[model samples]
Target: MRKKLPLGVSLFAMLLLLSSQAFAAPQSELWPTWDNSNESNSATFDHSQWQHLLDRYLTEEGQHTLFNYGAVSSQDKAVLEQYLTDLTSLDPRNYRQSEQFAYWVNLYNALTVKVILDEYPIKSITKLGGFLSFGPWDDKATTVAGQSLTLNDIEHRILRPIWNDSRIHYAVNCASLGCPNLAKTAFTAENTESLLDAAATQFTNSEKGASVDGNTLTLSSIYEWYGVDFGDNEQAILKQIDVYRDGKPLKGWSGKIQYDYDWSLNKP
Candidate 1:
């Protein structure tokens, strides 16, 4: 006959296990975790880990499987599966927004990349005959965090809602040639505020972005694309830039220039 365990002993063992897990802080410093340089809030990033993550998820041809719309090749899907496995262990609270934002943004973008990679060589994202055929991409299909998250969900639901700041437009790389370059490293929560500020300043400083050279200000099309993101009016938008920018006086000139969007999907 088998002996029954005492209730008290079983309870004690369970409590011990739970307590140890509670005490074990998640590993914050590990593969693919962002570490802030902590120098200037403006320049706080350590990309060594992020670069590795990018190499792992992004295909050798500089593409991804999931975010690929309908063109995900078998090779791409294999890599994406590996990435998802690694990501399952991630705990966002372990790092700062700068650190985690990159993770989330990249995750979103990578997933989209995988979608497109599945149907590699497609002329457009809409050829697959789903909500993608419609204008609003948010209707497209995806699942994250047990919720059906569309591309719009990542941008509108998770990213915009959490940050509540427009400057993110500059930092959250959309994997489009027109989108800002993906930061070489991930942004850390500790550095998020400063990083966002820097992104605004960097874009405004660029003559290509928004600047005046002898009364001729050649501005990037980003301003035109999401004008409402800045403010109701163009001048209002420029005023915000004025608050952050230095060097050549911006108070004097204001006018229109050509609008441009980089059409090439951001590839290696």
Candidate 2:
């Protein structure tokens, strides 16, 4: 007799097919030419193995998951914190090109979650204070492979030019409901396409992001912070938003965006 199909066999089959086609070879396999010989990348991650690890840790529930950190459904965020600690202990030199890429992406995200958990009830991320104050984001003093790192360092130092992909903005969610929703999975060089697409879609859809009503154009403060990354000027960012509008009709759009960084630990 033939083996019976599972209850949701059809859906599972569809997903498996998609995953098979969608999943690309790990970064190490793809970019054998990359030469980061030293341990500039974190040791715990294997650029070759990190994609799956991130997706798992990101989706993992209970212990390292944030499903039950403050309560509702699970401890997914809690799980994330533990993983952050675990990642910090890993040897960066152990990972190659892609593994290091995935590790930094995961590190940035995990740190963001940690920030919100510490100040769960705050209205905005800015409340943590500024450069001198050690706001919630600043307080993120985790040891990655024995080195203390901050969110700023991760972005400004590691992830930025190393990958040299500005699209990274979408991947790193700020935890504001207005900001892109933290992806349910971690970002790896292999699955980067999916993550970047998700980030762009989320940023476009969020009200805090660029939206239009008739001839008026409204945009999120993100456009302001990394405007240079988007384009040479405001017009450059506006032009990008125009494409995402899906025929929303462009006109004399102009407005000032008030920045509201989300610090509410991306729970749930």
Candidate 3:
């Protein structure tokens, strides 16, 4: 004969098993580090030049309005290209973690702008890909550290995986209105921490970040797609959002969460 446990006992045992399983899971690695200074004694890599260009072109709104593509001058284009070349030449392994973070972010943003310039006059970035694809994020757009790399490589493989910070979602602009504002000032090693925190705060306060209406909570598809990057579950994501929620965060927000994304080019 067989004996059955009480329903309460079965539930308690199940929860205990689940709890142990969760505790056994390995934690993600902390940010990568290098045994070198945060400075470049070789060549001064100031992104202030890029900041100047961004200031000249970007208009402040919830979305940073980029000027008409055709209006971009040859001189500006040359400067951007030179910056990319200089950045690619540097060995990030020689820089401090903060410097490396800034370098990668700047490289990603600059490359994104270059992609838009190379294929200008498009309605959406998604249209600039193969007939069956939406965009060219996977294409090897440049070489770094003697290896060819793509936009996906910089974002997914390196930045997101290595750093494991969700604030990055607010730093890398995809040239779309749905993305976080393309910062007016360039990211510098000196200002990386403050800038990252500011970016997170700004995005969460914006409508594109999180919107609540009664019982429904709407979030950007960025949160949904990259949920793991944010945290373990919805509550974790909400906790991150609450940290930067503007005005008043919704109370007792045990509501359904939905996602939306706009792929339109963020042009003036």
Predicted model with the maximum lDDT: 3
Q: Candidate 1's residue-wise lDDT over 1-268, tens digit each?
A: 9887799998888767764453221211222212222333343224343445555544323322112233434664666666654553454445555555766665664555555565566544434435314212445545443445566556655666565566867776545555555554446555567767876676666544664545456656766656666767767767767766777555445554454554455554
Which ranges of candidate 3 are over 4 A from the true structure?
1-44, 62-68
List the candidates ranked by TM-score, beginning with the highest.
Answer: 3, 2, 1
| lDDT on C-alpha atoms for all candidate structures | 0.53, 0.56, 0.76
TM-score, one value per model: 0.58, 0.64, 0.81
Candidates 2 and 3 compared: the better one by TM-score is 3
Off by over 4 Å in 1: 1-50, 53-79, 85-103, 122-136, 139-141, 211-218, 243-246
Task: Count clashing residue pairs per candidate.
Answer: 34, 26, 0
Name the 10 consecutive residues with the lowest summed lDDT in model 2: 23-32
Candidate 2 C-alpha error for residue 225, in Å:
0.9
The alpha-carbon root-mean-square deviation between model 2 and the true structure, to one decimal in Å, is 19.4
| TM-score for predicted model 1 compared with the true structure | 0.58
Candidates sorted by lDDT, best first: 3, 2, 1
Q: Write the per-residue lDDT of candidate 2 for residues 10-42, one digit (tens) a residue.
A: 678976775454322112112222225454644
Q: Where is model 2 more than 4 Å wrong at Cα?
A: 1-69, 72-78, 129-134, 242-245, 248-268
Sum up the clashes in candidate 3.
Answer: 0
Q: For residue 207, what is the lDDT in candidate 2?
A: 62
